[model samples]
Every structure is written in C-alpha cells, then in structure tokens.
Target: MLLCWLLFIPFIGGLACWFVSRRNPDSNAARWIALASMALVFLPALSLWFGGDFSLPSHLSASPDWNRELSVPWIQQFGIAFHLGLDGLSLIMVMLASVLGMLAIAASWSSVRSRVGLFHANLLWTLGGVIGIFLAIDLFLYFFFWELMLIPMYFLIALWGHEEYDRGAHMRAAIKFFIYTQTSGLLMLAAILGLVFAYYSETGILTFDYNQLLGAHVSGTFGFVLMLGFFIAFAVKLPSVPFHGWLADTQANSPSSGAADLSGILVKTAAYGLLRFTLPLFPEASAQFAPFAIALGLISIYYGAVMAFAQNDMKRLISYSSISHMGFVMIGLYAGTFLALQGVIVQVVASAISTAALFILAGQLYERMGTRDMRQLGGLFGRLGALPGFALIFVVASLGMPATANFIGEFLILFGAFSVMPWVVVVASGGMILAAVYALYLMHRVYWGTPQGQETIARMRAREYAIMMALVVITLIVGLFPNTVLSVTQGTMNDISHWFAAGVIAASQAS
Candidate 1:
C-alpha cells in the first residue's frame, strides 16, 4: 500500500493542483501545492535505498530476484496484474524521476505565467506517468503509463512553447512526437501480448508478471521478431538515428519546463525500458542483433556531435547532444558485460543531468536575452561568468570529460565493448573525440564566440546559480565517487550477466 501510495501521490497532487490552482492562481498555494506534493513523492523513492533488500540472493547471487516486488491481480482475464516492483536496476531510475520531477517544477518558477493551473497539471501528470513507468512491472501497466505520458507532454509543448514558434509549427512538432512514439509504443504492446499468449499456451497458466516471463525460451524467427518489436519501441524513445526525428522538435520548441522534463526525465524512460525489458526479456535476439545495434550507437555519437557542431540554435544543439549520449546507452546495453550494464545506468543518469542542466541554462538565457541563437549570443563568458561557468561544467560533462560522471560511464561502456567487439569499441571511441569538438564549439560559439551587440541580462541570478550548482555538484560527486553507484549497481548487473551467460552457455552447448 505504501509503495503504491508513493507512485500515485504525484498524480493525486496533480489533480488537486489543477482544481485548486484554477480557483486561486493568484496565491502561492498553487505553486506550494505542486512543490510540496513532488517533494513528498521524493521521500519514498529515497527510502528504498536504505530500507529494501539490496543484495543478490546468495543461492543465485549471479541471478538474484530483484528486490521489494509488490504484486496483485488487476485483470486476470488478460493475465495482467497491478504489478509494481523494483530492484537495483529500477530504483535508481525511480530516484532520478522523483528528483527531476521536483526540479521541473522549480525551473518553471516565474517562467510560466499564463494558464498556470493547466501548466502545472501537465507537468505533474508527466511526473506521475514517469513514476508509473519506473514502478510498473506488468506489461499492460507499463504500456498504460507509457501512453499516459504522451498527452500531458503534448499539451506542454503545443500550449506553452515559445510564441515565436507559430501554432502550425508547434502543432506539427507535437503531433510528430506523439505519432512516432505512440505508434511504436503499440508495437511493443502487441509484442507483449504475443509473449504472454505463447507462455499461456505452453504452461496452461497466464501472467504478464515480468518474473514469470523471464527465461521463457523460444527459438527460430519468432524469437527474433519479438526482439525486434521490443527494440523498435525502445529505439523510438531512444530515438536512435532514423528513429530520432521526433526529439529535436520536442526539445527545441517546448516551454522551458517541458524541455527540462523531456531532456531530463522523459527520454530516460525509453532508455530505462530498453535495459529493463528489451535485453533481458529477449537475450538471444538482443545478442544476435548486437553488431547492428553497436553500429547505430557509434553513429549516434559521431552524428549527434557533428550535428550539434553545425547548429546555430543552442537548444537544438543540446537536443543532438542527448541523441549522442543515449546512443552510448544503447552501446552499453548491447555490450553485455556487468561493467557495461553499470555503465549504461551511469550514462543515463549523467546524460540526463547534463542535458537537463543545459536546457535549464537555456531557459534562463531565454528568459533574459529573449533568444537561443548561439551566433547572436556571445560575450556571455565575460558578462555572465558564473552562468557560463556552470554551463561549462555541464558541457564538459556531456563531452565525457575526465573527472565528471559522464567519463566514468563512457569509460566502462568502451571497456566493456572492447572485450566483446574490439572493432566496435574503436569506432565508438571516435564519438569521444566528436564530443570534444561539439562541447568546445558550443562553448566558443555561445559563451565566448561573439556578442549579439549588447550584453543584455549580463549575469545569472542566485536562483539560476543555485539550480545549476546543484546539478554541477551531483555530477562532480558522482564523478569523484562513482563507486557509490557502482556498489548498488554491481549486485543487479551481476544477476543480469548471469542470466545472459546462462543463455549463452545454452547456445554454446547446443552448438
């Protein structure tokens, strides 16, 4: 009941804020209501770190059951359940969602003036859906939350995006984002139903509890196709290459808060889904497709960096940076090593922080300077030293600079890849160089390149400095002591590695 409460509280708060803010938008109640609600939501997520079983089961230390699972029947007829669970792999994602959800609300301060209630409604619901994604263990529940996130996000962009982006443009961007993810999201649902039906037919029992479905072996093309369905769904969200068209629209034009959430948290759900479901559920197919997936990952890194180098708009550049970082996450996933899996987790967290921080900086700039065009936005490093300095940290981190959190993740990912596919590792290394190119280019162009004729909004305010500093500290602390994360993550990664190893051994024996 308590775990479920933690999941639903944000949603309940959203609905309450909607009504209350509508009645009294003039008062601080609306903001406080939204803020307090989100803060409360953060508590339970953090509690999991200290309270739950955090160890691999000794009997199967290599493949322990994920900790603190909560399950109950919801739709028995379809084999669905009100199933929610977490292990080391998921708890970190949950914590990330909670922390960022609050930050999204904080970033909106003073930026969102019109339709305040409605905007908070969209924002809070977005967080709620994200929380749902982190908690849901049932396929149906997962898909339910997956689609549930779209509506609020769509409204966030179309209604609150910059006035300069005309209605048609905003509508087009919103619709494109919705259509792409929604269409692919359904394909994943179909795949889930197919897997469940197959399991029922074989065992005379039915369930979509992820635990039950684990290690449900299949052979031939069916296994491969099922894996494709899961991969495409996750990829659309990861927005890998051809699947990436939707990301820039959402990130570039969205309201600051929307952009923050999109970059900070929403994109993460897809990466989280890939690690939690796609690879583990269909290990053989994932392994089979490793080479092609690694190729896509490498391309995303170089391509995203190159594209960012060419961009004039700062927001769009950050969006491409996300594409590059997420690409590495995919690389980590397919690399299939314990260290690599942990790297994926670290990459997701680090990338989300850096990208989110970049956007928040963009929002602050937009609020002050009235534009995001990097060409018109120079001399900032001189006038707004602190702000540029903060931006530089996130920028360097995004570039995977050593002593930042991003470096640790990228290091493990490349090292892990070298073990299995040395050539792929070499190709991926180019992305690191490309990252430096873009990161430096962005720094030179926006902060130090040339001024836009005036030093409007010359410096960052305390609020802006505070938020950016918080993110900086998170990156540095984690960067310096990655072991804090690596310790908790090792227990889970070992289990996943054990499972994949079992499957691999089976394949080798049959050979």
Candidate 2:
C-alpha cells in the first residue's frame, strides 16, 4: 500500500498543481502543493531506509528477496500483474528521486514565471514516472513507465527551455531526444515481447512478471539479439558513446531543473535497468557482452572528457561530463566483481549529487549573467562572491577530489575493477587525469581569468545557498562514511554478483 502511494503521489500532486494553477495562476499554491507531494513521497522512502529489514538470509536462492512487494492481477490471460517491489537497491534510488525532485522545483521557482503551474505539473509527472521505473518489476509495467517519463520531459524542454539563438532549437532537441529514446525504447519493447513469448513457449506460461521470466531458458543467437535490444535502449538512455548524440543538445537547451533531472536522476535509471533487469534476466548474454561494453565505456570516458574540455557552453560541458562520469558506472557494472558492483551503486548516487549541483550552479550563473558560454564568462570569482567558491568545490568534486563522494566512488570503481580486468582498469585510470585537466580548465576559463564585464551580480539567495549546501553535505558524508549507502546495498549487490557468477560458470561448463 505504501509502495503504491509512493508511485501515485507525484501524479496526483501534478494534477492538483495543474488545477490549482488554473484557479490561482499567480499564487505560490502550486509550488507548495508539488513540494508537499514530493515530501510525502520522500518521507516514506526515508522511513524504509531507516526501519526496513534489508538483510539477506544466510541461505540465498535464485529468486531475490524484496523488502516490500505488492502484486494485483491486471491481465490474467497474459500473466501480467501490477507487480511492484522495493529493495535496498531501489530504496536508495527512490529517495534520490524524491530529494532531487524537490530541489528541481526549488531551482525552477523564480526562473519559470510563465505557466508556472503547468511546468511544475510536468516536473512532478516526470518524477512520478521515474519512481515507477525504479519500482515496476513487471516488464510490461517497466516499459510503460519507461515511455511515460519521456513525454513530460519532452514538454519540459520543448516548452520552457532556453532559446538563445534559435526559437525552435529547444523543440528540435526535444524531438530528437524523443525520437532517439522512443525508437530505442520500441526495440526494447520488442525484446520484452520476444522474451515473454519465448518463456511461454518453453514453460507454457505467458507472463511479463520479471521473477517468472528470470528463470526462462534463453540462450543462443535469439537470446543475444533480445539482450541487444535491451542493451541498446539502456545505452541510449545512458547515452553511452555512439548513442549520446542527443544528450548534449538536449541538456544545452533544457531549463536548468530539467538538465539536473536529466543528468542526476534520469540517466541513473539506465544503470538501474542494466543492474536490475538486463544482467539478471540474461546473465549469460550479459557476461558475453561485458568486454565490448567495457570498450564502449572506455570510449565514452575519453570522448566525453575531450568534448567537455572543448566546450564553451557551461551546460554542454556539464552534459559531456555526465557522459564521462557514467563511463565508470558502465565499467563497474560489467566488471563482474562484488566490490565493483558496490562501487557502481556509490558512483550512481555520488555522481548524481555532484553533477546536479554543477547544473544548478550553472543555472544560477546564467540567471545573473544571461549567458553560459565560458568564453563570455571569466573573472566573476570576486564579482559573484560565494558562487565562485561553490563552483570551485563542485568542480573539484567532479574531478573526484578527496573528501567528496566523487572521489570515493571513482576510487572504489577503479580499485575494485582492477582485480578482474587489470589492463582495462589501467587504461580507465587515465580518465581521472583528463578529468582533472578539464575540471581545472573549467574553473580557470570561467572564474579565474580577466573579468568579462563589470556587471553587478547578485549574491547567492537563501534558497540557492541552501540547495548547494545540502548537496555538499550529502557528498561529504557519503565520501567519508560510504558505508551508510554501502551497507544498504550490500546484500542486493552480493545477490547479483552471485547470480552472474553462477551464470558464467554454467556457460563455461556447457561450452
């Protein structure tokens, strides 16, 4: 019941915000309502984090253990149910979504004056769909949420995005994003259907239930093809290398809040999907594909870093940086070790916080200076007061500075993956050096050079300061005591590691 409410609150609140805005367009009622709704969602997830029993039993099985689960019959003939489950893995993600959702609202508070209510409605709806993606265990249900989140995001970029040079640029970006994701999504849908039909043929049970489908006998060329379908979708969402074409433009044009969601929360879903569904559903195929995935991860790491260094647009720089950061996540996922998997979880959360903070800071700079081009932005360090300091800290964190979560995440990922794939880890470590170069270059280009102009920039507002401080605190805490997150995700990661390892052994033995 609580799980159901967590999924529905954002949607309900979005509608409520829409109605309230229609009645009182000028009032802050809609904002408060959306915030309250997000609060409602966050509170329950936090309680689960604190109070729920997530420990695994001494004896493990092929089936996973859930902290909470709810299933109701929806399509009996097809073996589909409205199945939802929560585990430590998902609990952490849900909490991240709720917190980021609220901050996105706060970020958009003043900048979005027109259609304020509608804008927030889309924001909340987008978040609702995200939570659904995290929770939905049924493949049918997962795809439903997968596609659902894109529409509101399209609206967010298309309707409210910045249009500096071209009026239609934002719309074009939105459409491109939609087409890329939607087309890849359809491929995943086909793969899902193929998996369901294959399972039905094997066991004479037609179902989209993930648990039931998990044990389905899928192998050979057919299984690999289906796995590719899922992989392509997640990769595009991850925006890994070749499929990352839409992300820079999309983030470059989107409103700040929208970009924050894209980098902070939305991309993490791809990592989650890979962890939760792809690896578990088709472990053998995933094991076979690991090497290639690592290669692509290497490409994204270097490519994103190089592109970010060359960018003058601050938002585009951050967007490309996200592609680089997520490269570590890809390597961690396929590294096939317990420690690397744990590192992947930490990296997902830490990167989300640090990257989102950067996007928010960029938005603030844009608001004050009316530009995000780094060439046009220099020596505002003294002029912007604490904003430059905030940028410096997050920029350092982005490069994986110690005492920040980014450092802990990247260190663990490289350290853990080195044991399994020494050569790959050796190559990936160079990305950190490149990362520092870009990070320092960003600071030097934007805040350390000669003053761009003598404009009177406003100091950080209370709301803005609070947002940055909150993120900084969280990053530091995770950096210092990562066990806070690791403990919760340990049992889950152990189960996945064991499952994948077992599949590897089985495949090798059969061969």
Candidate 3:
C-alpha cells in the first residue's frame, strides 16, 4: 500500500514529464511536473517515517526483520513475491532520497533548458528506481530495480553531461559506466541465484524472500565464495579502491543533478547493500573478511584524498573526496559494533548532502565561468558574494568539521573501530589530515589567489541559494542532533551487530 505508492508516484510521473515534453517542447511545464512528482513521492516517505513503528522489536528473530511489509506472489513457481518492506534504516534512507531528488530537480531547472522534459523524466525515473532499491525485499525484485536505475542514469550522462568539448565525451563516460555496473550486476545476479539454489538444496524450497533465505544455513568454502560475489558487487558500487575507475570520469562529466544523485544517493546504496545484505546474509564470511576490508577502507581514504588534491577538475575532485568519505563509512561497517554502525548511518547521510552541495556549487561555477578547472578559478570569492563563504563552510564540513554531521560520524566510527581494530583505526585517521589538505587547497585555489577566469562572476540566485541552504540546514540538523537518526536506527543496528556476533560464535563452535 504505502510502500507501493512511494515507488509508483515517481515512475508514473516520469512518464508524465515525457508526455508533457512531447506536447510542448522547450517549455518549463515538464520541469514543474517533475518537481510535483518528486513532491508527491516525499509525502508518503514522510508518513512512513512519522506514522510507523521503526524500531526492530527485541522479540524478533536473529535475522534482521522488517517493521512493516507488504507481499503479493509474483512468480509462484519460483517462490518470488513482490515484497516491499520498511525499517528505521530504510525509512531514513528513503526520506533522504526524496529530499535530494527534489533538490536535484531544483538544481537542474535553469541549466537544462534545451531538453527540460527529457532531463527531468530521467531524473524522476532514477529517483524512482533508487526508492525501489530501498524497499524491495525480494532478491529478484531488488536486482530488477537495481539494473533499472542505471539505464536512466546512462541517458542522463549521455544526453546532458558536460565532458564533451568534443562529440563523444559523454558517450564514452556513459558506456564505461554501463559496462562497469552491468558486469558487476551480472556477478551479483549469479550470487543471488546461487543462494536460492543453495537454500533449495537444503530445504527443497525455492525462494528469493530475504527473511526466508536468511534462515537457511550457509557456511564453509561455498558460502564464502557466494559471499565474495555479493561483496564484489557492493564494493564496486561503493567504488572501493582498484574498482573505482568509473566514478571520477562519470561525475566529472555529469550534469549537476546527475552528479548529485551519483554522489549523494547512488553511492550510498552500496553502503546500504553492505549493511542490509552483505554482513547479514553471510556473517561468517564477512567477519572473516573484516581485516582485509578494513585495510581496503584505509586505502580508499588516502587514495581518494591524494587524488582529489592532485585533480584540477572540480567534479573529479569532489568525486574523489566522496571516495575518501566513504572510506570512513566502510571502516564503520566492518567494525561490526553498535557505535561504528551508528557512525556508518550518520556518515552516509552527511556525506551525501555535503557532496551534493559541492556538485551544485560546481554547476553554478560553470554557469558563471564556463569551466570547472581549478587552475582557471581563483579570487572570485569576493566577486561571488556569499558563494565563496558557502563553499568554505561545505569544504570544512567535507573535512569533518565539528558541529557538522561528518565530524560526529567520523568520531564515532573511530571510537568504535578503535576497540576492535586499533591499529587499522590509527592508520586510517591519517586520512583526516589528507582531507583537510585537499579541502583547504581546493578553497585556496578557487577563491583566494586571483580571479583567473575570463568570464564575469555571478552571485547566487534565489533558487541556488535555496538549494544550498536547504542542504546546509539538513547537515546542521544532523550534526547538532544526531540523536534523531541514532534513535531511529538504534534497534536495527543492534540487531545487525548482534547477528554478526552470533555468526562469529557459531563459526567458532563449528570449527
């Protein structure tokens, strides 16, 4: 019911936007229609968060359980169902998705004048698919939405992106994105089917339901292999080191809104999958894999920070910064403690908003100066009025400044991870230094030295101001009162943490 409508509104509205465009090409009608659609989607997400019992009750089983669910048989012969569920974890994610979706639309309004309808149609569709990802409880259904989301994003980059001063820049980036994600998706699909068949062999029940499959016994070498499949898929999506080739290129070329969705929400899905599926689905394998995973998190942190410092392109710099921020998130996830997990959730939201605001700022700079090369940007700080100051605040926030959400998240992640992997946390903390170096360097190059661009600088418009300020307010709220998110997600994090603990115990007993 409520869950179904959440998915329905954005998808249908996407089509409506296309139709609106068809009727009147080059009109603002399509933009408003798309905005309205995103608005409609937000209402339901709000209701679900405020109106539902988000906590995972103590009486629930060892498996992570949903607080509210709706199911209808879809492929009975194969035991597939159109299952949708919501818990505190997903409730917060859905709400973030909707809020960012609207802001992305607002950010795009003036920049996408040529193909307003098509641009927004893709936007809404991408948001719809993301929402579906958050809600789908059936593995088959989840994979469907997962792949579904990427298509519209391909169109977004291919059609509206800025990489091409030449003919095929956007196409190259889009193709690379498609190939990378699609290949990873195939690997994930193989693993999902592997799990299903594994369960069927043990109990003679063919099912793709998350809860049912969770109860199936999966361990040993074969279980480890399947877990690797799932982990690789999530890691690539997380764009962990050695597998992050596509991220910088895609974000560098993408339109502001596309980059926003990519940095803010799309990447966050990888973290969600790790939390919701990777650890819980194969806890023993995940626990066994923690040390290596923590090492990789440390690598991503320094790697991203170093690359961001070296980059001249604004979008690429921000993309790499995202990699650095997600590194902390990765550490929290693998730490497998309540405090660390709590930090993971907070960091996810905070990082998304901060990165999104930067992308939006990049777009604004392009609109004024017509280039994102930091070499060509300097001393426009005074010329652009408060934009320089705004950029300063966001840059500081990106570096995990106190009273901002990133600080709270990074602090908790370090605090919790220290208990389990003291040496790793100690090494990873060096990334914060790198973060400050690049962040301040970015600000200095773009705003302090001298106005290097040939074009005139412009002040922030009402629309742009609104978009940035809204993100600013959200980040401040999360930073000032993280308890709102922590309280909502506590029960579920407890369940997930406990599940990993149980897995470790069970593995020890078996050994």
Candidate 4:
C-alpha cells in the first residue's frame, strides 16, 4: 500500500494541477499544486529512509526482494497485476525524484513566467511516470509509464524551454527524444512479449510477472536477440556513445529546469533499467557480452571527456560530462565484482549530485553573464567570491579529486575493473586524465583570468546556495564514509553477482 501510494500521489496531484487552470489558469495554482502533491509523495519515501528497512534481514546484500511492496490483480485474466515494489536500488531513486523534483520547482520559481500551471503539471506528471518505472513489476505497466514519461517531457521542453529555442527547436528535440526512446521502447516490448510467451510455452503459464520469468529457459540465439532489444533501450537512454546524439540538442534547447530533470533523473532510468530489467532478464547474454560492454563503457568515458574539453557552451559540456560519468557506471556494473557494484551505487548517487549541481550553477552563470561562451566568461571570482570557490569544489569533485565522492566511486570502479580485466582498467584510466583536462579548462575559461566587465556578477541567492550546499554536504559525507551507502547495497549486489556468475558459466559451457 505504501509503495502504491508513493507512485499514485504524484499522478493524482499532476491531474489536479491540470485542473488548476480551470478556477484560474495561472501558474501559481499549478506551482502550489506541484509542490503540495510532491510533498505527499515524500512521506512514503521517508518511511523507507528512516523507518522501513532498506534491506532484507539476511547477511547477504543483493536480492530481488524489495523492502516495501504492493500487489493486486489488475488483469487477473491475463496474470498481470498492479504489482509494485521497492528495494535499495529503487529506494534511492525515489528519494532522488522527490529531492530533485522539489529543487527543480525552485529552479523554475521565477524563471518560467509563461504557462506556470502547465509547467508544474508537466513536471509532476513526468515524475509520476519515473516513479512508475522504478516500482512497476508488471512489464506492461512499466512500458506504459515509460511512454507516459515521454509526453510531459515533450511539452516541458517544447513549450517552456529557452526562448532562443524558438518554435522548431523544442519540437525537434521532443521528436528526437520520442523517436529514439520509442523505437527502443518497441524493441523492449518485443523482448517482454517473448519472455512471457517463452514461459508459457514451457510451463503452460502466461504471465508478465518478473518472478515467474526469472528462470525461464531459452536458447543462446534467443537470449542474444532479446537481450539486444533490452540493451538498445537502456543504451539509448544511457545514451551510450553512438546513441547519445539526442542528449546535446535536448540540453542545449530545453529550459535549464527541464535539463535538470532530464540530466539528473530521466537518463538515470536507463541505467536503472539496465540493472533491473536487462541484465537480470537475460543474464546469460549479459555474461556472454560483459567484456564487449566493458569496452563500450571505456570508450564512452574517454570520448565524452575529450569532447567535453572541446565544448565552450556550458550546457553541452555538462551534457557530455554526464556521458563520461555514466561510462564509469556502466563499466562498474558489467565488472560483476562486489566492490565494483558498490562503486556503481555510489557513482549513481554522486553523479546525480555533482552533475546536477554543475548544471544548476551553469544555469545561474548564464542568467548572470547572459552567455555560455567561454571567451565571454572571464574572472568574476573576486566579484562572485564564495560562489566561485564553491563552484571549484564541485568541479574538482566532478574531476574526481582524491577525497571527494567521485574519487571514491572511480577508485572502486578501477579496483573492480582491474580484478576482472586489468587491460581494460589500464585503458579506462585515460578517462580520468581527460576529465581533469576538461574540468580544469572549463574552470580556467569560466572562472579564471580577468573579469569580463562587471555585468554578470550577482551574488548567489539564499535558496540556490541552500540547494547547492545540500548537494555539497552529500558528496562529502558519502565520499568520506562510503559505507553509509555500501552497507545497505552489499547484500543486493552479492545476490545479483551470483546470479550473473551462473549465467556466465552457462554461456561459457554452451559456447
């Protein structure tokens, strides 16, 4: 019941926000509706954080078990149910949704003047869909919400994004996002259908339930094709290298607020999907392809870092940096080591914190300078004072400075990668160097040298500082004592690790 309420609260509130315009279609009602409803969603998530157990009572860490769950027959005739659940994997994500959702509302507090009600409406709905993705155990429900998320986002980008985005920019970005994910969505649906049918053929049971499909048998070629379907869907969202073409345009044209949600929470769904759906669903294929996948992660790291160094536009640079960060996340995930999996958990949380912080700060910088060009940005460190220093901390943390959370994540990833494949680790190290180059270059260009006039030097606001400081404190605390996250995650990852090991051995024997 708590799990169901957690997902439904935002949805019901989002619908109510749409009606805010009826009494007075102004943005205030919409904003209030968004804020108030999101407040409701937070309660259930808080239960998991402080009261409910984040893990099972067992000694091992990783498992499919969720600490809180809700289930009821939705389509009993077809064996589908309104099944929803949460474990360490999704508990963290829902918590992120609540926090970032609140902050994004804050970011848009004064920035979005037009269609205020509509904006919050879209924002709340988008989150509802994301929460659905995290909790839905039914395949159909998962895909339904997956597509549900796409619509509100399309509106958010096309309607309220940067004015320079003009008319077609939003349409173009929205359409591109739709096409990429929709195509991949179709592929994933196919795989889901295949799994259900495969289970039915063997056991005379037709169900879209995850538990039922887990040990269903399939041939190598079959698993390979199905896994490809799932992988492509996850990869496009991860926006891994070749499939990443949509990210830059979306970030560049969309409102900074929309970009925050997209970068901070939306793209993460792909990584989450990879862990929850793709790898676990097709373990044999995943194990068979782990080495190749690790190579892709390595490639994305260096490629994104190098490209980030070349970009002068603030949004685009961070967009590319997101790519680089997810690269490490992907590598660690595929490594199948305990430490590496722990690194993935830290990396996901830290990446969201650090990258989103940079994006928000960049938005502030843009508001000040009225430009994102490196050449136009010169030292305002004296004028900006503490902000530049704070920005530097985020930058170095992003660059993986030794004591920062980013360093802890990278260290674990490298250590885990080395244990599995030393040569891959050797190559992946170059990404760290490239990250330094780009991060420092951006620092020098944006915050160093002389002041480019005194035009863009407004001191940081209390609200923005509060939001950023929260992110800062989280990075420090999580980095210093990683066990805070690791302890809860250890059991879950170990269960997942053993699951994949069996698949790897099976695949090897078959080959």
Each model's lDDT comes to: 0.82, 0.91, 0.89, 0.82
Error of 3 at 37 (Å): 1.3
How would you encode candidate 2's per-residue C-alpha lDDT over 311-333 as one tens digit per residue?
99999999999999999999999
Which one wins on lDDT?
2
What lDDT, from 0 to 1, does candidate 2 have?
0.91
Query: How high is the lDDT of residue 335 in model 4?
Result: 85
On TM-score, the candidate that comes out on top is 2
| Candidate 2 local Cα displacement, residue 260, angstroms | 0.4
* Candidate 2 backbone collisions, by pair: none
- When summed lDDT is taken over every stretch of 10 residues in candidate 3, the lowest stretch is 56-65
Residue 507 lDDT (model 4)? 89
* Model 2 misplacement above 4 A: 452-456
List, residue by residue over 156-209, the lDDT tens digit for candidate 3. 999998953556787899999999999999989999999999999999999999
Candidate 3 residues lying further than 4 Å off, grouped into runs, are: 164-166, 452-456, 509-511
Please report the TM-score between candidate 2 and the true structure: 0.98
lDDT of 4: 0.82
- Estimate the TM-score of every prediction: 0.96, 0.98, 0.97, 0.95
Ordered list by TM-score, greatest first: 2, 3, 1, 4
